[model samples]
Target: MYINPEQLSSYAAKFINLLIDYSPKLISAFLVLFVGLYAIKFINRIIRKIMEKRNLDPTLTKFLADILLWALRILLFVTFISNLGIETSSFVAILGAMGLAVGLSLQGSLSNFAGGMLIIVFKPFKVGDTIEAQGVIATVLEIQIFVTKMLTGNNQTVFVPNGALSNGTIINYSMQGERRADLTFSVSYDSDIKKAKDILLEVLNKNPKVLQKPAPEVFVKNLSASSVDFAVRPWAKNANYGAVFSETLEDCKTALDQAGISVQPFTLQK
Candidate 1:
């Protein structure tokens, strides 16, 4: 075989020319990537400030800002790649296919994520609120992307899926500044109804935790063959509900006993 020095020289010259032509484009892509990342951070910070000024939910605001920043960065990366002379249409198609496959595989997780978004946006309950949902009564500890953490009355931590929580009935006990404690006391049929009512009202009035505005009420709620039930309802600040309720019941019992009132014994219905 015969080798040609002129042909080898020409091939080297072509390689050098191609590298020279692509150098600026490669550098431009790198510069664009750096600027794009900085821009994304700045945009996210601005969004956070705006949401905070509007008093938006912290969970929702953070989630939205993160999603927006990532989407923008992804677009920027695609543009950067295109500047390097790569066709991005096929790349985008591949990404779309991957996304669809991931979505299908994580249906439940996606549902929970959506539910968490709804929870944050609508705010049926917030952190520190005492709520009952999905058969669990607890104080909300944290609202995460896919689940909510709560502390139960017994001091147990429970993680509830946002999917079921959003769809189920939720009772937010702390939404209102005040809550009512509905307590019942039973008296023997032989006891005086008016006397029992007065005792219960006195107990309620003396309790400092009970709210004075709504005014406590004690009335005969039910009359049975063996006992008469009196309803003792008192309004208290949500934070003081447990203390006020327990104290009222104890005070009512002591007052009734001192006043010679008899409580009815529990009897199974025939």
Candidate 2:
């Protein structure tokens, strides 16, 4: 440890020179990073407002805003690195390769994400809609990035993957504003067909939930080995479908009982 003062001073000078040369670039990079982050936030806010003004779906709005924010951040990251005199081509290439690998590993998740995007864009169904898909009939609670959350009639929460939902057949009962309730009531073969039909029609007409425009219809649908089946078709607003259906069935049974008609127990077929 017998270093000369001249050599020590030379090392100190070189260190100070290096710091001096890099300080401005470092400061500029930090400044760019901070400003870029603020700009991204401001841009995201503006975009959200625009989407709201256009009355876009809330789910779509959030998804699009997040995607844009991340994209801008990535670009800003590249700029920040380049300002520090670091080459970014290799960095971007690495990012691309990583993204590709992640994408390949998450094929199903990516499919679901794509499906969610399509649902948001096309709007085959929306929140609060009664949709039947994949053998589940439930009200849509939330349309997320990879799955659609639903509330079943029995208070069960179901998550349906958006990939299968978008590709499969979706029956949106609420989209039409009105739904036709198809009810089948079975009675003894000895019951008077005309009397039973009239009684069912009367019950539908009296019910406030049933729509009067489309009118209700009751007809002999089939004759089983021991019972007669009557198809009762009634139309009601989408919101009142469940009420109308259940109420009509109960009222019809009561009416038949009062009219000396024996109702046969029937099992509902999905």
**lDDT winner:** 2
Per-residue alpha-carbon lDDT of model 1 for 1-270, expressed as tens digits?
887999999999999999999999999999988998999899889999999999987777777887898889889989899889888999999989999999999999998999998898899999999999999999999888889999999999999999989998999999988999887788898898898898889889999999999999888888877799888899999989989888887888899999999977652221
Best by TM-score: 2
| Model 1 weakest 10-residue run by lDDT | 261-270
Q: What TM-score, computed on C-alpha atoms, does each candidate reach?
A: 0.83, 0.89
For candidate 2, lDDT tens digit of each residue in 131-200? 9999999999999889999999999999999999999999999898998988889888888989989999
Predicted structure 2, TM vs. truth: 0.89
Model 2: CA > 4 A from native: 1-17, 267-270
Candidate 1 ranges beyond 4 A from true positions: 1-26, 265-270
lDDT scores in order: 0.89, 0.92
